[model samples]
Target: MVDGAIAGAVGSAALNVVSYLDVAVRARPTSSTPEETVGRLAGLAHVDLGPEDRAANRRSGLGAVLGYAVGIGAGAVLGALAGTRRMPLAVGTALLGGATMATTDASLAVLRISDPRTWRRSDWMADLVPHLAYGMAAAATLNRLRPPSARCG
Candidate 1:
C-alpha cells in the first residue's frame, strides 16, 4: 500500500509537470474543470464553502488535492490488483492510465462538468498526454518497488 501510494505520488507529479509544460508551450489558459468540479460537487452535497473569494480559493486547493487523491487511490488499487504478479510495463501503463482517465472522465460526465462528446481533438490530446505520462511513471515506480518475494521469476 505504501509503495503504491509513493508510486502514485510520483505519477501525479509527472502528470502535473507534463500539464504545466503543455500550458507553457500552448500559452492557453489553465483548465478550470477542476475548480468547477469541486463547485458542482459541493453544491450537490449541500456544503457551503464560505464567501465567494474564500470559496474560490478553497475550490482551487481542493481541486488539486482531489486530483492527488484520485491518483493515489488508483495506484493503491493497481497495487492490490497486481499483488504477487509481475505485469508488463506496457500493460501496467495502459491499465493504470485507462483507469485514471476513465475515473476522471466518468466523474465529470456524471456531474455535468465537461462533456467528452464535445471535446475537440486538441482537448483530447491535452488530456491524453499527461495521463500517459502519469501511467508510465506510476507503473514504473510500482514495479521498481515490487517486493523481491513477489517476483514471478
Candidate 2:
C-alpha cells in the first residue's frame, strides 16, 4: 500500500510538472502575428473560460484535482482487481485516461476553450514527453509494487 501510494504521488507530481512545462512552452512568442499569438496564448493559459457559455469548458482547479482523484481511484481499483499483473492494469488505466483526456479536451473545444490541434511545437513537445513519462512511471511503479491487498488474486 505504501509503495502504491508513493507511486501515485510521484506520478501526480510528474504530471503536474508536465502541466507547468506545457504552460511555459505555450507562453513563448512565435513567428505569427506576435500580438494575436500572445493574446491567444494568454487566453488559452489563463482565461476565465468557464463563465462564457461559448467557452465554458474550463474546469476549476479543484475540479481538475477531483478529476485526478477519480483517475487514481479508478486506477487503484483496477490494479487491485488485476492483482500483480500491474502492467496490463496500468495500460488499461492509461488507455482509459487517454480516452478521458481526449473527451475533456474535446469538450473544451466545444466550449471554445484551448484547441490543442493549433498548439505550437513547443507546446506539443513539452506536454507530450511529460505525460508519456507520467504514464510509464505510474504503470511501472504500480505494477512493480503490488500492494498486499492486490496480491491475493
Candidate 3:
C-alpha cells in the first residue's frame, strides 16, 4: 500500500509536468472538461458550492485536484495488481495508459463533459503523449520498487 501510494504520487507528478510543459509549448488554453464534469456531478448530487461567484473558482480548483486523485488512484490499483501478477514492462505501460485513458474518457462521456469522438487529431495527440509518459513513469517506478526476484521481464 505504501509503495502504491508513492508510485501513484510520482506518476501523478509526471502527468502534471507533462501537462504544464504542453501548456508552455503550445500556449493553448487548459481544457475545462474537468471543471465541467465536477459541476455536472455536483448538480446531480445537489451539492451546493457556495454562492455563484465563488462556486466557479472552487469547481475549477476541485477539478484539477480530481484529476490528480484519479491518477493516484489508478497508480495504486496498478501497483497492487503488479505485486500479485508480474507484468512485462511494455505490457504494464500499455495497461496503465489505456486504463487512464479509459477512465477519463468514460467519465467525460457519461457526464457529457466532452466526447472523444469529436476530438481533433492534435487534441488526441496532446492527451496521449502525457498519458504515455505517466504510464512509463508509473510502471517503471512500481517495477523498481519490487524485489529483484519479483520483478517482471
Q: CA lDDT of each candidate?
A: 0.89, 0.52, 0.82
Spell out the clash pairs found in candidate 3. none
Q: TM-score for each prediction?
A: 0.95, 0.50, 0.92
Stretches off by above 4 angstroms in model 2 are: 1-9, 21-64, 70-74, 77-81, 88-100, 147-153
> What range of 10 consecutive residues in model 1 has the weakest lDDT sum?
144-153
lDDT of 3 at 16: 79
lDDT of 2 by residue, 62-153 (tens): 44454456446534554555556545645644653464356445655565556788989866565456555556556666766764344323
TM-score of 3: 0.92
Give the distance in Å from residue 113's predicted Cα in candidate 1 to where it truly belongs: 1.0
Superposition error at 36 for model 2 (Å): 20
The candidate scoring highest on TM-score is: 1
Model 3: ten consecutive residues of lowest lDDT: 80-89
Q: In model 1, which residue pairs have backbone atoms overlapping below 3 Å?
A: none
Point out where model 3 deviates above 4 Å: 84-86
lDDT of 3: 0.82
